[model samples]
Target chain A: MYNPQAENIIIVKDLVKKFGSFYANDHLSFEVKKGEIFGFLGANGAGKTTAIKILCGLSYPTSGKLNVGGFDIYKEREKIKRNIGYMSQKFSLYDDLTVFENIRFYAGIYGLRRKEIEERAASLMQKLDMKEARDKLIRSIPLGWKQKLAFSVAIIHNPKIVFLDEPTGGVDPVTRRQFWDMIFEASSEGITVFVTTHYMDEAEYCDRVSIMVDGRIAALDTPDNLKKHYGAGSMNEVFLKLARVKVE
Target chain B: MKRFLGFVVKEFYHIFRDYRTLLILFGLPAIQLLLFGFVITNEIKDARIAILDQSKDEVTRRISEKVLSSGYFILDKNLTSYKEIEQVFRQGNIRLVLVFGPDFSKNLDKTGNARVQIIGDASDPNTANILVNYLQGILSNYLISLNAEKIPMQIVPEVRMMYNGQMKGVYMFVPGLMAMLLMLISALMTSLSITKEKELGTMELLLVSPLKPIQIIIGKVFPYVFLAFIDACIIIILGNTVFGVPVVGSVGLLLLESFLYICMALSLGILISTITSSQQIAMMLSLVALMLPTILLSGFIFPVENMPWILQVFCHIMPPKYFITIIKSIMLQGNGFRYIALETGIMAGFTLFFIFLSVKKFKIRLA
Candidate 1:
């Protein structure tokens, strides 16, 4: 029943996850604040997915103290689940389902009242400028629109936080920018965004970024601050500098 | 409750919208029932044969009359020479040719012996064998009648076939078809659909939602259970109407037992989903582990009693084997729960065991 403190919505302390003596996540710790976009960055096989899974309640931590939305990870996993929304790297909407059907499905599982689901779904379509395409199956829509639709459905329940696992992978830059616009709009409505990405440019758009190397948090700061601290001119160079160091 | 209802509705959407699943769920049972009931049956009707009576005597003519009246064969031709036997068979219509030796009932009167030659087309071995057997039965009965007055003390054997009196092939294959179709819809299709969600990454999204793991699994199973039940009804109706196989037991009890078996199959599907993470792997495992084993070892095409010891042991472990047994007993023998309670109990036990095993495995894999 310990408090998560005033500013932080997520708190992790010495989170250790091991798979048969191999530490997929080794002694990790970080915090995400309310209404802030926190970017989680890592190279492939650097354990970012494992950490996100732990936070999302999809996996168990070997040993650690973790809390999200003021609920213990060990005791109140269900409460944590209720408070968060997630979209995976793959566009997770049903390809056979229409856009409105997809939205209603997520809204329904979140236990939204019928009238509320209807109102939100109509407005969600308006926001995406997809009212004309609302009845189209997800497979028939363009990739960019599908990605945006996926993000919109992920937050249909008005969760306190939305987790996007490399949400912009393989998307065009213009669409990625539009997607970030939606993210900014949600943050303005006080929905904290916790996202992971391989794109350094997307990392720069986040309020703060954490880089994990070899299952440990090697760097955590504002993108501009990290750039200045490393004496590099861009976040890309800053990433290259940290990732090239070999771990003993 | 509303939330769970919505989840089930979505599942139904997936099922109905997919044409492939629809075909397998509804179309397959009917196709299989017809194929096994009528087209591939073992019973013979109106087989054609030719007659060659060289003696042209009363005995040969009487034998020919009896053969035609048996209702199993048609007289394709009356041949006067032996060369016509080979020619009739080459036409592929005649299954057998009966030839009588030269005699006017003289040999039977003088030496108390008569000879007849039966030539059969063996291109299709099974039909040839059965045709020969039927001819033998007809000739032997005729000979018995002829010797009725001359025999001294004789012992006659009374032969009566119980359960299925005529050994109709539909009686045997209908129960087996029911087992295969139910398992296909319940276990194989359910496992495929569940793993499809995992492969598409929606399972991760669902897990991150408010729905509990058990609720998710149940929601996935409900639609398939309903579909499989409908399929079972279709098979039973077809078996009764088209094939004339009766449900001699209580109709309600038959449905209830089928429901129990469907639950067992659905739970096994969930267990398979827990172990596999991709649709292709789930599909391969379901076909290899469940479908093939059920069809081959469940006494469907082959009798479990006639199988080798190792295969018999395998059949005993097969869930569909017990289902086919229960179906045959209840439908053919007019048996009630008193007779098939053991199989029903075994299926219920499997349902519980699969549910428990999947719960434990799911927890250990994640939290």
Candidate 2:
């Protein structure tokens, strides 16, 4: 069951995931609101993927009070799975499958009917201006196009929230802009976007950004507020100020 | 159920699209079976030998004729002296040297015994041993016929090879081939396909979907079951038509047993995928852990009884050993359920054990 009244789509409190004695995610708490672009920024080993996986129901938390898309993380994992979509840092589409086939397969697994899958797939191809690539295998496409198609396929079922873990990692600058434009379009359509990225310039695009350092959030605020608070000119400078001291 | 079907359809796409997978799935089985049947066999034929006939008597000539005409050996040279025995064997084309003692007919009639020195080249010991056995068989049969009227109270043991009358190597290889091919295609290919999803990061997307873990596993494994069953059929048909290996038992029983074996291999594949995160690791594990034991210790190429006792213990645990036994009994011996009941039960036990372990080891969530 969905809670239409719940403003925060993802709520986490004291979330912790441990590996033996090492805490991959330590006391991480944040809230992602409905229809908002939330940027989760961190360094390579700062546990951004761990938190994203936990929120997407791809991993269990060691101990936490968490809910995703209004479903209890512990008790209603299957429900959480139905209500959200995830795109990992690695390319998510099957390389051997054609674009339309990839779209149809992922959509079908989420319980979409055949007609629904075909209809949505055709419309998605039109929206992305990818009619020529519809029959092309994913491996034949460019990495930027693959990432974009992966994002579209992830949200093919119109889930309440979509989680992108470094979706634009290897994409060129022009394609990254286009990718973000697609993200904005999805958010405008009332889908909450929870994206994790190490690129600081990408951070300025989010409505609000949280920077994690050493398995804990170092700062959380709007991009401009963090810049002004840290007396920096850009989000990059703010990030350096937040994470550099801890690095030393 | 629809979702599961769609997942299986996707799995078929993955399998059919890759040319390498297609080659490995269908091509390897035929090639391996033919190779095992014709090229790599234990049966010796047309082995060359040198005969030294010191006695110009009828008995020695008949014995030499019997040895050379048995079709197992060809006369390379007729040596005139004992010194030529070492030289002929050293020449290396001849596999054996048959040296008949001088005055052989006189000695056998007067002393009731004669020495025929059979010196075999033991460099390739197995072939040498087989040639010696064939020569002995021919000589003993000739002696039996020569003494038939004189000896009336000799107790001759009647040996009847029960199932394989010709003792064709092909009959043995058909079952062994089925076990190996099914295990390889079912276990190695399935493990690779599943771990491929993990390696390429598509597993993360799959894990987030509404499809449960069990659904994902079954979907991934279902297509391989179909493919491996087809492989089993191909091997059986080829073995029957090409090698004339009989399927004397009920075809339904044979198929049921093959289905059970394929299930066991598929479950083992799932177990391997759960433990390893990379396709390379899964492949290595399947090859090293499954293929070697199936070929060496499962009574495939080497008889398990002839192996070391420790290896026999290992063979008992090898799932393929029971399967090979079941197949041989069913295909060659034409036995019904009652005859191979213990082996069938053991195979079922292995299938259940592997399924249980894989389910227990399966990760509900990515770690």
Candidate 3:
């Protein structure tokens, strides 16, 4: 796959998002290449969700130079939005709708035609081996299946960049592995993946991961390299060491 | 445009697929309209009254017959003593009591006037007042028929009921029903729609979608507008069939007014949803803010003109007040566009203001 060069798919300079007296995201800057599995690692309230929100065009940056998919977020928000698919930590899906219906609804909103939606949904379900559950309501499925389905629906239209915010939250280990396989599959097809996770172990799956502490990037590197550089045996130990250093 | 339509379709699916919301959206208005139109009304009909005849004379009997035949009161019991009055009222059926003095015919024959005491249950002041007024009118009419001596009265007051000729309770209630039903359905629907997203976690999903803040709000509100219209139709139909309230004005004009009112209510609902993150809060706010004001301040059950100045001013700000006035004028008085244009304009202004406010608030939340 063709990877993005210094021309970053996502580029942020001194990004700041404040909620009243509290700065949710403080002077944060980051860059991700095209076709990169960029893991955004942070503890709860580390501004991971806030940063993802800005990148996905859901919220405004207080003062920042932010660009995603070659479009400025402020003026070209519509263009930026069109290029990204976001699955929030909640595994947001309509519980009342069947799996097929949910897929169609999302696809339709993305302006996909009926035939395109049908073809895409069929292939995606086939890949997930979710044909039997396709007609069942989303609420009836297991949490693991729902999380995977949510991730699948997020990128159903094949956005240039897919953002998964804690996508494996509350899911089983097996499901997490299966989910990573899907992410890798998307990356192999030249789709860039940006994911946020509290699970430090899952950070190992990212091609390059950025660890955020107190709304700033405390560390950014490949998981193997981060472990080696920190003199740690695993990504979790590296995350813990970085978190302690930042707190100090 | 296709994307917007798709968003709206998803909204409809959310509404229709939830049987609870569907029932409330469609069923609530129907039930409320029926209840307001038929069950609860101010028009006094077949009220049971007790009569005590101490004279047992012809004049007393003739007057009692007149009272019973007026259709306002039904002579349910003949009480021998005054002690039975409290018992009759406590039973809750008797609303009026007429007590005749011992010299009923003697006084009338000697001075052309007889003393009769009218005792009414004042627990419900409005019902008591109406019953008393109705009894006085019947008595006055009976006396006029008995003696044809025309005495020139000093003050000849010509009272004209402008809008409703008979001042039918249904005429007043139809418009009130429209305001109430629209508020209930619109507010409930919008609140539920917002809460459903929060509950299902789809709001975060939509926030992350390519849809703009405005598009998401429009998508959520669009289906409710259609649902509110359906509720309006149900109320109108119920008002006509059950209450015999004729729509005097142009149906088109009434509908236009109703549309503006629905928009105002829907915008208010959207505004409430923005402040409240839960369905329970939405429902409570809708009920307290929308329902009560629509009922009490909009001339639905009580006259706005009769309220205190502060309450009257508050009523002026309520969208339903203007809507009720326009609707009542149209449905009862057959008022043309020229007559109700000001009220309709006011309603449109409110709709615009609410929409503007909600959009501003929504944008602020996103920002």
Top-TM-score structure, candidate number: 2
* Candidate 3 per-residue C-alpha lDDT over A1-248 given as tens digits, one digit per residue, 9 for 90 to 100: 33445358888999999999888888998888988899999888999999988888768899999989999988988887778898887889888889999999899877899999999999988988889998999889988888888888989888999988888888788888988888899998888999988887788888898998888888888888898999999999999998898778
**Candidate 3 lDDT by residue in tens digits, B117-210:** 9999999999999999999988877776666556654343578987667877677777787888888888767976887687667887787777
Q: List residue ranges in candidate 3 displaced over 4 A.
A: A1-7, B90-92, B149-163
RMSD of each: 2.9, 2.3, 2.4
Residues forming the 10-long window of minimal summed lDDT in candidate 3 chain A: A1-10
Of 2 and 3, the candidate ahead on DockQ is: 2
User: How do the residues B29-97 of candidate 1 rate in per-residue lDDT, one tens digit apiece?
Assistant: 999888887789787879999988989988888999999999988998999898878888999889989
B243 in model 3: Cα distance from truth in Å?
A: 2.8
Supply candidate 3's per-residue lDDT for B220. 89
Residue A152 shift from truth in candidate 3, angstroms? 0.9
Q: Model 1's CAPRI class? A: high
TM-score of chain A of each: 0.96, 0.96, 0.95
Descending-DockQ candidate ranking: 1, 2, 3
Which ranges of candidate 2 are over 4 A from the true structure? A1-6, B364-367
lDDT of 2 by residue, B1-367 (tens): 9999999999999999999999999999999989989997778989999999899799988888888789899999999998988888887899999999898999999999898999999999899899899988898899899989999888799889988888898889999999999999999999999999999988878888999988999999999999999999999999999999999999899999999999999999988998999998999999999999999999988888898888889999999999999999999889999988999899889889988887777754355
Q: Pairing residues by index, what is the TM-score of model 2?
A: 0.96
